[model samples]
Target: MHNWNDPGGKGSACQADKDRKDATRIAGQLNIPIHIRDFSQNYWDDVFRHFLDEYAAGRTPNPDVLCNREIKFKTFLQAAIDLGAGCIATGHYARIRKHQGHYQLLRGCDPDKDQSYFLHTLGQQQLAQACFPIGDLRKPQVRELARQAGFATYDKKDSTGVCFIGERDFRKFLAHYLPAQPGFILDTQGHPLGEHPGALYFTLGQRQGLGLGGVQGAHQAPWYVVGKNVTHNTLTVAQGDAGHWLDALRLLTSQPSWVAEKPPGKSFLCTAKTRYRQPDQSCQVQVLDDHCEVIFEQAQRAPTPGQAVVFYAEELCLGGATIEATDAAFGGLEAST
Candidate 1:
């Protein structure tokens, strides 16, 4: 199984050493030799660079999705093939099946830990070459099995946010790659309430780390980030539920890809999620050659651009696309005073 050593953005330089120790210990127990591969260069080119570009564009991106498609499936898969391997496997909580001469990507039986959303970019080629040994098992079941088998990573805490950030302040880590652009924090009426280190550092519906306490004309209610303008270098905040202002009913995405290479039909209805762990939302889809448009039955909050929208039908993963634009009003996000 492949475990990425470098995840991106300020990942510890000694990450490889840590991985090697665990991998060596486990391989020794299993009486198998482990070959450690360094794909950090490939990771930077295919995953980290794209992540930085998306953030620079003032849009949040999911690096795990990029890493799965680029590093795990593309680069690592090729390396395994070169080493005379028939197929490669990972510990991802996803499943693959062969039916009617086509590989089907399915969600893991462990619903709470399902990772199909991150694997949506994978196509038939990757699916055919990929394996998920624990997809049919729940988290606890897998952990118990690993305990019985004496595996070191069985109890490893799941990484959150960006893997490379690794408990480090996200703002501080990102500030290193993208030079800080200090700007004013304003309200809906263009009133400057406070100052922000950078407009690109925040996301819609975010409340913490804003440092907006005791601003003039601000209400006693807690403030939330409602909008941002990267070009103009400003952030917009609103008290109370700023989330409603960021709700999006429809979104447009770039370069859609399907597991079967073509969608069920040119237009179809299916379930989708704007982010992981979000309940599957019923939506209507319209696929174009260049992009696809999805209209949700209910408004979704903060469907950030540069993140992916993954499609599903029952347990089968159809595919996904990169969110590009949303229909949210967002307090007239780019409006300048």
Candidate 2:
């Protein structure tokens, strides 16, 4: 067994140490020789650079996905191989299988805890030597098994949200790396509603932290981020529900990384999720020379760019790509001013 604690400077040191200790105890109980690797600076710099680059490009990035691909699967996997290990297993709620002489990635039995979305970047080579020990068990069952085994983490609360941020203010944490450029918040008609800290700080369908109170002329409804003009440093918001802006039937994604090594054909049908924990939606995927285009059976909500759009066929995870653009428009957005 091996425990990889990324000892990046900042607040992660404590968590890394705690996790290492836990892994150590578990290894001792299981009577297995444990290995530890400290991937501090390289892992931190690579992931942080991607985060800043995405925000600068006016898009929200998924660092967790990159972390799993670059660090957990790539770096750590290689390290395990160097240690003469034939296969590497993890606690991730994902399953890998071999079918017809090819490796395949599958969703965990626990639907709510399935992590196939983040593991979409994995290829056939990696899946061939990977294992998920607890993929068939639900969270509660896993916890119960741990308790029966006398493990201290049996009741540990599950972690969520951005890993590095912990419980800190997201805006403030981001400002440290990407300095905010305050700009005017405009309505659909290009009327100024208020001032926002930064256009990059907000995303489509965002409702909270807009800081806009009741405007005398505008409707009393709460504001929602409808659009953003990143080039002009302007954030477009709309009063009342902003559901109209999020409706999109089609989206274009960057070069997709298919789990099977390449796409099945020129065009194929599949279900996809543009964000983590999102319910799978039906879609038709058209593979293009430069990118992939997705036409959903029903209009999707908030298909934000810079996030990953993972494709799936039933329980099998096909692959994913970074969303580059969406054909969604803000036509129905009403602005009193």
Clashes of 2: 0
lDDT winner: 1
Please state the error at residue 80 of candidate 1 in Å.
Answer: 0.6
Clash list (residue pairs), candidate 1: none
Candidate 1 minimal-lDDT segment of 10 residues: 1-10
lDDT of 1 at 252: 87
Give the alpha carbon lDDT tens digit for every residue of 227-283 in model 1. Answer: 888998898888887766688888888979899998888899999999999999999
Please provide, for model 2 over 1-337, each residue's C-alpha lDDT reduced to its tens digit, 9 standing for 90 to 100.
2222333354544565677798899889999999877665556666767888899878889988888888888888898999999989998999988899899999999999999999999998789878999999999999999999999989988878877766567887788778878899988889888888889888888988888886668767888887887789998887786667667787888969999999877899999999888999999899998689888888788888889999999999999888887766652223212
Alpha-carbon runs more than 4 Å astray in model 1: 1-11, 14-16, 331-337
Off by over 4 Å in 2: 1-11, 330-337
As a whole number from 0 to 100, the lDDT of residue 13 in candidate 1 is: 38
